[model samples]
Target: MLGQALLMALRALRLNLLRSLLTMLGIVIGVASVVTVLAIGSGAQSQVTRQIRAIGANVLMINPGAARQGGLRLKAGTRATLTEGDVDAILEQVPQVRAAAGSIAGSAQAVRENRNWNTTVNGTTTNHFVVRDWTLSSGRTFNATEEAMAGKVAVLGSVVARELFGTDDPVGAEIRVMNVPFEVVGVLSPKGPDQDDVAFVPLSTAKLRFLGSAGGTARDAVAYILAKAVSDEAMARAKASIEDLLRQRHRIQDDQEDDFKVQDPSAAAEAQRGATRTVAILLTSIAGVSLLVGGISIMNIMIVSVTERTREIGIRRALGARGRDIRLQFLCESLVLCLAGGLVGVVLGATISLTVARSAGWTTVIDPSAVAVAVGFSAITGLFFGLYPAHRAARLDPVEALKAE
Candidate 1:
C-alpha cells in the first residue's frame, strides 16, 4: 500500500513537471546561498589562522608601550620610553630567557652596479637569529666578532639578491648602501614578503656608518627586543619578569602602567583563534535562516497542493479508502516532495562548495556532519508542515467534499 502511494505521489509530480521544478526553485536558491556563505567564511577564518601561525606562534615580542583597555592605543602625553638597558636586563636577569636580542630598523636605498632598490635595513646583534627564530638558509649569520667589530658585512634577502645580482651569486659581493660599501656575507631564503624583502646589518655598523645614534627622541627608532622562553612552562614567568623589570626601571607607581608592552605571540594566536571561531559560528547561524526559509516554501506549496487535490481525495474516499490511508498517502506525498528537493539541493550546494574551494582558492570543508544536518532538518520540515493538511484531507466527508466541487 505504501509503495503504491509513493508511486502515485511521484506520478502526480511527474504530470506537472515544470510546476514542481518551479516550486522547488525557492529551496534551491536558499540552500545554495547558505552553503556558499558558510564555506567562504570558514575558508577566510582558516587562512587567517594560517597566516598568524606562520609568524612563530611560540615567540614573544617586547614592544615599547603600555597595554590599554582597547589594546595598544597611543594617546596624548603617553610615556615615550623603552631602552637598551631594559633589553640587557631581560637577558641577564630573567633565567627563563633563552635568547634575547634588540633591534632598530629603517629603510634606505641600496645601490649595486648602479642598480638601486629600496629596502629595509635592520640592525641587530648576532643573537637576533635565535630570538627571532631565524636560521641561515645559505652562508651564515653574523657572528659575535662581526657585531663587536661593527663589520660592514650584510645579508641580502632573496628578493634583494634576485633584484641586484640576478644569476650571479651574491656572497662576497659588495653592495653600496647610501654610498657605503658593504660586503654581502649570505643570501637569505625566499620567505616572501613581511620577512624576505629586507637587508640586514650589524646594529653598530648601521648606526655608525649609515644612521646617526638614536638620541631617545627619534620616533622611528626602535628599542624593540625579542626573547624566546626557555620552555613552554616558563613563558608566563618570563613575561612577568620582563614586564616588572621594565616598569621598575621606568619608576612608575605600583598602580601606574608601564611605559612598555610585552606581547606573547602564542597568546595572540590563541585569542585570534577564539575570535575566528566566534565569527564562523555567527556566520553559520545567519546562513541557517535560509534553510528555515526553504522549509517555509515547502510548507506553503504543500498546502496549495492539498487544496487543488480535494476532488481526488473525495474520489479515493468514495472508492472505499480508509481515512488513515488518505492521511498516509498525503503525508507520504509531502515527504516525497521534501526529500526529493533535499537530494537535489544537497547536490547543488555541494557542487557550489567544491567549485568555490577549487577556483577561489578557498578551504571548503564539506563535513559529513553538515550533510546529515541538512537531511535531518529537511525531513523534520516535512513532518511539521505536512501534518495539518494531511489531517484536513483525511477528515473530509466524501459526499460533502464531492458536492462542494
Candidate 2:
C-alpha cells in the first residue's frame, strides 16, 4: 500500500515537472548551506589543533604578567620580574620538567649586501630550540662555545632565509641585525607563515649588544620561559612544582597574587574548539530558516494540488477509496520531494566545499553526521508542513465535490 502511494505521488509530480523542481529549490539551498558551513568549521578546528600540536602540547609557557583580573590582564613582558634564575630553579627543582629555556624578543632590521628585510629577533639559550621542538633544515644550531662567548651568530627561520638570500643558501652568509654584523649559522625548517618570519641569536650576544638596559641595571631579565614536561602525564606536576619554586624565589606571600602566568596549549586549543562549535551552530541555525521557507513552499503547493484534484478526490472516495489512503498519498508526495532535494543538496554542498578548498585554500571537512542530519531534518520538514494540506484533501465532501463540476 505504501509503495503504491509513493508511485502515485511520483506520477502526480511528473505532470508538472517544472513546478516541482522550483518547489524543491529552497530545500536544496538550505541543506547545501548547512553542510558547507559545518564542513568548513570542522576543518578549521582540525587545522588549529594540528598547528597547536606542532608547537608541542606538552610544553608550557611562563610569562611575566599578573593573572587576569576583571577584564584587565597585563600583557606579556609588561613586567620585568621573570629572570634566568627562575628558569634554573624550574629545571633543577621540578623533577617532572625535562628542559627549560628563556627568551627575550625584539624586532630588528636585517641587512645583507644589497637586500634588507625587517624580522623578529629572539635572544635565546641553546635549549630554546629543544623546548620548541624546532629542527634545522640546513647547517647546524649555534654551538655552546658561541653561546658562552656571546658570539655574533644567528639562525634564520625559513621566511627570513628566503627574503634575505632568495634562491641562494643562507648558511655562512653574513647578515647585520640593527647595524651589528652577525654570521648566519643555520636555516630552520618551515614552521608555517607566522613562525617563519623570525630569527634567533644567542642570549649572551643579545644582552651584550641589542638588549642593554637604559638605566645600566642588570640585564638578566627575560621576557618569557618555555618548559617541556618529561611526559604528557607529568604536565600537571611540572606546573605545580614550577609555581611553588617561583613563589618562594619571588618572595610572594601565600596570600599575595602571582606576578607571572603559565599557559597550557592544550587548554587554549580546547577553548578554540568550543568557539568554533558555537559559530558552526549559529550558522546552521541561520540555514535552518531557509529550510523553514522551503517547508512553507511545499505546503502552499500541496494546497493548490488539493484544490485542483478536488473532483478526482471525490471520485475516488465514491469508488471506495478511504480518507486515510488519500491522506497517505499526499504525505508521500511531500516526503519524496524533500528527500530528493536533500540528496541533491548533499552532493552540491560537497562539490562547493572542495572547490573552495582548492581555490581559496580554506580547509573543509565533510562530516557524515552533518549530511545525515540535513537529510533527516528535510524529511521531517516535509511531514510537518504537508499535514494540514493532506487533512484538507481527506475531508472533502464527495457529494458536494462531484456536484460542483
Candidate 3:
C-alpha cells in the first residue's frame, strides 16, 4: 500500500514536472546556502586554531606602550622603552617563565644576485626561536656563540626563501640586507601568513648594520619581548611577575601607568574564534529562514494540488480507498519533492564550496553532520507543511467532490 502511494505520487509529480521543479527551487537554494556557509565557517575556525597552535598558547608579548610628548601621544612600540634587560629580568625573576627573547624589527630589501624582494627583518636572540616555537626546515639555527659575537648569519622564512632562491636550497647562500652581506644559515618551516614573510638576523648585526646604533642605545632597546611560560596554566602568573619586575626596573610610581603592556596571544585567539562562531550562527539563522519560506511555498502548492484533484480523491474514496491512504499519498509526494531537492542542493553546495576554496586560496571543510541535518530538516519541513493539505484532501465529502465539475 505504501509503495503504491509513492508510485502514484511520482506519477502525479511527473504530470506537472515544471511546477514541481519550480516549487522545489526554493528548498534547493536554501539548503545550498546553508551548506556553503558552514563549510567556509568551519574552514576559518580550523585556520585560526592552526595559527594559535603554531604560536603556542603559553606565550606572552610585552610591548612598549604609547608615550605622550608635548600633549601628543605616540603609537605603541614607538617609545623604545622595552630593553633586553627586561627580557633577562623576566626569565630570572619569573619562576613560571621557561624562556624569553627580546626583538626589534625593520623593513629591508633582500638581494641575492639580481633577484630581490622586500621583507621584514627581525633582530632577535637564539631564545626567540624557543619563545616562538619556530623550527628549522633546513640546515640549523644559529647558536648562542654566533648570537653573542653578532655573526652576520641569517635565517630565511619559507616565503622569503621561495621568493629569493626558488627551488634551490638557501642554506649557506649569501644574501645582502641593505647592502650588508650575510650568509643564510637556515630556513624556517611554514607558519601561514604574517609569520612567513620575514627574515631573522642576529640581534647585534641588525642593531649595528641596518637599524643603526643610537650611541649604543639601539643594542639595548628592543621593540618587544616574547616570553614563554613553563606551561599553559602558568601564563597568567608569569605575566604578573614580568609586569611587576618591569615596573620596578622602570621605576614607575603607584599612581603612574607602566611604560609597557603585557599581551596574551591566547586571549586574542579566543576572541577571534568567538567572533567567527557568532557570524556562522547568524548566517545559518538567515539561511534557515529561507528554508521556512521554501516550506511555505510547498504548503501553498500542495493545497492547490488537493483542490485540483478533488474529483480524483472522491473517486478513490468511492472505490473503498481509506482516508488515511489518500492522506499518505499526498504526504509521500511532499516528502519525495523535498528529499530530491535536498540531494540536489547538497551536490550544488559542495561544488560551490570546493570551487571557492580552490580559486580564492581558502580552506573549506564540509561536515557530514551538517549535510545530514540539512536533509533531515528539509524532510521535516515537507511533512509539517504538507500535513494540513493532506488532512483537508482526506476529509473531502465524496458526494460533493464527485458533483464538482
Candidate 4:
C-alpha cells in the first residue's frame, strides 16, 4: 500500500517538473546560504587561533602603561619606566619565568643601492628570538660581543630581503638603515605577511643609531618586554610574580596605581573566539529566516497540489483507499522535494565556499555538522509545512470531490 502511494506521489510531481523545480528554489537558496556562512566563519576562527599560537604559548607581554578607570588602557610606552634591568630582574627573580627580552621598535627606510623599502626596525637581544619562538632561515644571529659593542649588524625578514636583494643572498650584504650602514647577518623564516616587513638589529645599535633619546633616559628606556613562562601552567604565576617584582622596583605605595600592563595571549585568543562565535550565531539566525520563508512556500504549493488532484483523491477514496493513505502520499511528496533541494544546496554551498577561499585568499573550513544540520532542518520543514495540506486533502468527502470538475 505504501509503495503504491509513493509511486502515485512521484507520478503527480513528474507531470509538472518545471513547477516543482521552481518550488524547491527557496529551500535550495536558504540551505546554501546557511552552510556557506558557517564554513567561512569557522575557517576565520581557526586561522585566528593558529596565528595567536604562532606567537608561542606560555608567553606574556609587558608594556609600560597604567590601566585607567572605566576599563581604558593607556597606550604602550606611555610611561617609559621599564628598562633592560627589568628584563634581567624578571628572569632572575621569577621562578616561573623561563626567559625574557627587552625590545624597542621604530620605522626606517632600508636601502641597498637603488632598491629601497620602508620597514619596521626592531631593537632586541638574542633572547627576543627565543621569546618569540623565531628561527633564522640563513646565517647566524648576533652574539653577545656584537650586542655589547653595539656592532652595526642586522637580520632581515623575508619581505625585506626580497625587496632589497631580490634573488641575491642577503647574508654578508650591507644595507643602509636611516642612512646608517649595517651588515646583514641573517634572514629570518617567514611569519606571514604582517611580520615579514620587519628588520631586527642589536638593541645597542638601534638605540645608538635610530630612536635616540626619544622615549626616556637612554640607559633606562625600552618600549616593552617579552617573556616566556616555564610552561603553560606557570603563566599565571609568572604574571603575578612579574607584577609584584615591578611594583617593588618602582617603589609604588600600596594605593598607588601600577605603571605597567601584563598581557596573556591566551586571554586575547579566547576573546576573539567569543566574538567569532557571536557573529556566527547572528548570521545563522538571519539564514534561518530564509529557511522559514522557504517552508511557507512549500506549504502554499502543497495546498495548490491537493486542490488540482481533487478528482484523483476522490477516485482513490472510492476504490477503498484509506484517508491516512492519501495524507501519507502527499506528505511523502513534500519530503522528497525538500530532500532533493537539500542535496543540491549542499553541493552549491561547498562550491561557493571553495571559490571564495581561492578568490579572496580567505580560509574556509567546511564543517560536516553544518551539512547534517542543514539536511535535517529541511526534512523537518517539509513535515511541518506538509501537515495542513495533507490533512485538508484527507478530510475532503469523496462524494463532493468526485462531483468537482
TM-score of each: 0.72, 0.78, 0.90, 0.83
Candidate 3 scores a C-alpha RMSD against the true structure in Å of 2.6
> In candidate 1, which residue ranges exceed 4 Å CA deviation?
1-26, 66-80, 165-172, 189-192, 215-222, 231-233, 253-257, 310-405
Tens-digit lDDT string for candidate 1 (67-145): 3456666552234475666667888899998888777777899888968899998888777777655666677878788
Q: What local distance difference test score does each model get?
A: 0.75, 0.88, 0.90, 0.88
Candidate 4 regions with alpha-carbon error over 4 angstroms: 1-22, 66-76, 314-329, 343-369, 387-404
Q: Candidate 3 at 357: error in angstroms?
A: 5.9
For model 4, residues 39-108, the per-residue Cα lDDT tens digits are: 9899989888887766776889999875344677656556678888898899899999988988889889
Pairs with backbone N, CA or C atoms under 3 Å apart (clashes), candidate 4: none
Identify the superior model by TM-score, candidate 1 or candidate 2: 2
- Segments in model 3 whose C-alpha atoms lie over 4 Å from true places: 1-3, 213-218, 318-320, 347-364, 396-404
lDDT assessment of candidate 4: 0.88
Off by over 4 Å in 2: 1-22, 66-76, 213-217, 282-293, 296-300, 310-332, 343-376, 379-405
lDDT of 3 by residue, 1-405 (tens): 989999999999999999999989988988998899899989989988887877765899899878788999988865778887888888888999999998888899999998999999999988888888898899888787888888999999999999999999999999999999999999999988778999999887888778753224445888888999999889888889988999999999999998899999888988998898899999989888988999999999999999999999989999999889999999999998888889888998899999999999989999999999989989998999989999999999998989777
Clashing residue pairs in candidate 3 are: none
Tens-digit lDDT track of model 2 for 307-361: 9888989888999889999999999999988998899889998999999999999
True lDDT of residue 389, candidate 1: 78
